[model samples]
Target: MATSGRREVARRILRLTDGIEESHEVHEPVFDIKDTPIESLENAVNPLVPFLPDIRKHAVTAKKACKNPPPDGLTLDESASIRLYSMEWVPHDKCLYVVLNDTLRSEDGEKVKPWFLYLKLFRTAFERLPKQHLTELENYQRAVDIGMHSLPSNHPNFQQWKKALESAKEN
Candidate 1:
């Protein structure tokens, strides 16, 4: 049953990401790993990007929604390698069910370096989703606690380019 559920989730994710066109540039609002203080995008988003191409597609879909919803049957947890990531309820005692498709961004005739770097960025962005969402949730809670009923004016995530700056600091 878990396997079936995972497969269904993968199918839905695929459908969502399949909307991106090859001709147009998709403006994805990704957490800029370059400026993020983290050592590497890999450190920010591990297991999540295990299969790059797949995750890239989902990212495109996520961009459309402007939200980061975890894959079905998955739960966020602290992984030693990533500040925050998730482990799905894998059947047969496996740890993860999603496979990030890292190869989708590569050109048919392109060299390997760009593909490698892009995939790295993609993975980091994927991993950063949980952290960002958690931070947003925390910010929301903080706002509620203080009776503001809205994000604080100085809320860390409210500004443009905040992710890049934060990532740079971590680095």
Candidate 2:
């Protein structure tokens, strides 16, 4: 994998695991114009193409994690499948928090664990978002636009989330 790809995978893993006792070496961003031409950069940074590989890896890992029975000797229901229940956008974080239905349960009928999926809004596959989510994004952007324009310059909330939203939208 390219350095960017590796970084993306590491990022997803860290997010999923909440960085519990995890450490990753940080590397300076590289922009090798010579090695990676401008066209390649354009393609690499394309929102649709940039995150497919990372998302695929995440899907596979999540599948395996959910499919296997828990170590506590609990058996998963054969008919159970992970299902997305709802998604909420966190404008401050520039990410979507996906809540999923329980896909596994103990033999005693207790829920095993709940899965939380985080999808970073910037530099990611927007197609992963449902039409309703896209509408939510539009609604949020409109609300921010209105707030930025209507709020007084010196108001504490003025331009608070505008900058972050603009930055994320750029990606």
Candidate 3:
């Protein structure tokens, strides 16, 4: 069931970014190691460039919609469940991943999860994306520890990010 749901979500996401492509190659350090200097991290983690304004707008709206969802709209937990499952380049297999807070459960003690959507963005989107969303992507990466095992205890804004994750985990 979850697999089919994921496919549907992926289809929707692909439709949303249809026609977008990378205008140029993107170069950045691999996300396999931790403790890499932030200044030295040059590659844009999640290349969301071509869909810029719309993507950012969608993110902002999603954040708000998650916070105060309508009666028939997604709940906070539901929204958090809808996350970036994968963003990878076809040739190299490089990817950006998200870790979900999976504390939400159903009455039967099974995990009542949402779909995970995968998107393939153009490499050029990295260069064209707005700074705010870029920063947010970094935060998202940090939250999920995409490249590393865990976020550093002393990393700046760690508490705030943790709190945000906690809020999303709530029922």
lDDT of each: 0.38, 0.32, 0.33
Span of ten consecutive residues with least summed lDDT in model 3: 112-121
Provide the lDDT at 49 for model 3: 27
Task: For residues 84-126, write the lDDT of model 3, one tens digit per residue.
Answer: 2232232212112211112111122222111111111222223
The candidate that wins on lDDT is 1
Per-residue lDDT tens digits of candidate 1, residues 46-66? 334543434433333333433
Q: Output the number of the TM-score-best candidate.
A: 2
| Model 1 local distance difference test score | 0.38
In model 2, the runs with Cα more than 4 Å from the true position are 1-139, 144-150
TM-score of each: 0.19, 0.21, 0.20
The clash tally of candidate 1 reads 19
Among residues 3 or more apart in sequence or in different chains, the pairs in candidate 2 whose N, CA or C atoms overlap within 3 Å are none
Report how far off residue 170 is in candidate 3 (Å): 22
How many backbone clashes are present in model 3? 1
Stronger candidate by lDDT (2 vs 3)? 3
